[model samples]
Target: MAQQAYMTETDNQGSGHEPRGTRIRRLMSRLANRLFAGGRDGRGIWRRGMVLTALAVLVGLIMLLHAQVPNTIGNSGSLIETFLPWLGVSVPVLLVLALVRRSATALIAVLFPAIVWLNLFGGLLGDKAGTGGDLTVATHNVNADNPDPAGTARDVAASGADVVALEELKTSAVPVYEKALASTYRYHSVQGTVGLWSKYPMTGVRAVDIQLGWTRAMRATVTTPEGQVAVYVAHMPSVRVKMEAGFTARQRDKSADALGEAIADEKLTKVVLLGDLNGTMNDRALNGVTSQMRSTQGAAGSGFGFSWPASFPMARIDQILVKGIEPESSWTLPETGSDHLPVAARVSVDTSS
Candidate 1:
């Protein structure tokens, strides 16, 4: 009877230990399964995050490209490109984060804005040695609707620019400009919406067809003390704003191409182009003129001096470009009645060469 009871106790103890071990093994296996599944689910989360990052990068790049188009067709307003160059920096930063995470799509999307930024500002990095000269010329588009043409003219004439180009000349207000500028400019000519007022002798003043009409653009021979320089004053057609047609930049681009061709055929080695281009120097559409001429303000101005809608100027549409002159200084004048403030530059004609 004592042996039987002892054997029964031993069997019970052994059976209890086996069951406990089995239960522990099953629990461990279940935990291992959950951990493995969680890892797989975490990969999906990472993929989704990568997709979102790529979408953001793509949207940023598209915005950057859209901003790059010319404003000649329709003004991009003050909000888009003028205050938006810094927006492009976001793309590369996001791309870096994506790359760190090994996201292929996000890395690919970054290339768009990268190409655009380089296209717009790359040439600016090259060496810009001025070819020295004697005469200084400046240009501006004193808005035709300017309430104070006299004040605007006075400010521009005060710059002491030997030659000044004005565009967007309103026919009714021509007398006002003529009277205010007469004291400084001894010679002047107008063709369509463009005009040239000079302290020097101006000849061969004929209108150049930019396809706007009779004379929105013109070329003149300014016989300065240094030599006869070909000066072109132009105001391409103003782009209109409409809710239906996005940007109408094609017409302006075509006009620019024509003007560029005209300029290229000129025999003179030294050329000066001045007026309200209605487009930024950074715009690739203006490459027609920008490819040949150097912007004075871009070369010597302190910053990205915005010059349109004078109340709160945000982008520089007015410009002075030179082919064979040295720019000493460039700046914008104070507000006038017109929507645009005058932009002036001091360029020395390198006659010594």
Candidate 2:
């Protein structure tokens, strides 16, 4: 009987059976450990992915908004083109974020602003070199307060421009400019605060209403060797500075719109617009003009070509725009007595077009 009992006890131990309650507890403990491990790993991955996605979306939104703002406002001091190059930075940053997160959706979203920005400013990035027949034209803002009109006229004549357009012309300096430039240009006319001097025959010269008193803008026909071309010289209203309102950009914007409408209605095919625009090509307000006409400097110049306040030029307020002409080369000339530097261009009149 003792042997039987001992054998039975050993068999029960070797069978590996525990009380039901203990077995259930052991199984539950194992399951809880597995569940906790899985939850921890999942949470860590989710957090990392969320952080990366949020960063990408945030950067992309900022870039989009920045690209949408119109560069020019009434009296805004900053030029629009200065901020155009920053879009390039945004594109790369978004691309890097997309790669790091491995988010295909975010990568796709980045293309919207990238395309818009490039479409508007892509031409500025490429090489602007091209060949065409030579037709020299010059544009300058002579500054109403210019002290040395003779010096300014002499400098303008030195540029070898076939046509010269002057802005901010004051009555006091008119005689000096007339005397200095008289020997070079055979034809000249002053409508209001602006004037045009040309080597070729100028006729049908009349003032254009650009919202300034009298005649701040005028159009003339230049009989060149190739053909007749219409040239417009304009000096838009000066943008005022005030502490109450950030740059009063509305007036300039309205003028630009009106000017654009006028230009669009003109019967002439070949047109050249020269002046101190008080804004740059990248400014959205100037889109009224910039969208219709091609800027010679932007097409063929080597650098940013900033031409305003010549002593420390931060913006290219002075400009030469061409329509129905192929620009070959463009550059800024040495400073004269005026506050703005002269911008010159060599263009080819495409009469065939």
Best by TM-score: 2
Query: What is the lDDT of every predicted structure here?
Result: 0.73, 0.77
For candidate 1, lDDT tens digit of each residue in 1-353? 77667657767643435477877998998865553323435662235346646666565665556545445545563225443555556767766666555554556666766676666655444444343436767677877678888888898888788888888889998889999999999999988777899999988989998766567789999988778889998886665456876555667767888888889988888898988777777566677898999887778666666788788776788888888776766778777677877777766765464
Scanning candidate 1 in windows of ten residues, the lowest lDDT window is 36-45
How well does candidate 2 match the true structure, expressed as C-alpha RMSD?
A: 12.9
Residues 119-179, model 2: lDDT tens digits: 6657666667566655899988988888788898999989999999998889888888899
Task: List TM-scores for all candidates, in order.
Answer: 0.70, 0.70
lDDT of candidate 2 at residue 133, scale 0 to 100: 57
**Candidate 1 global TM-score:** 0.70
Q: Which candidate number has the best lDDT?
A: 2
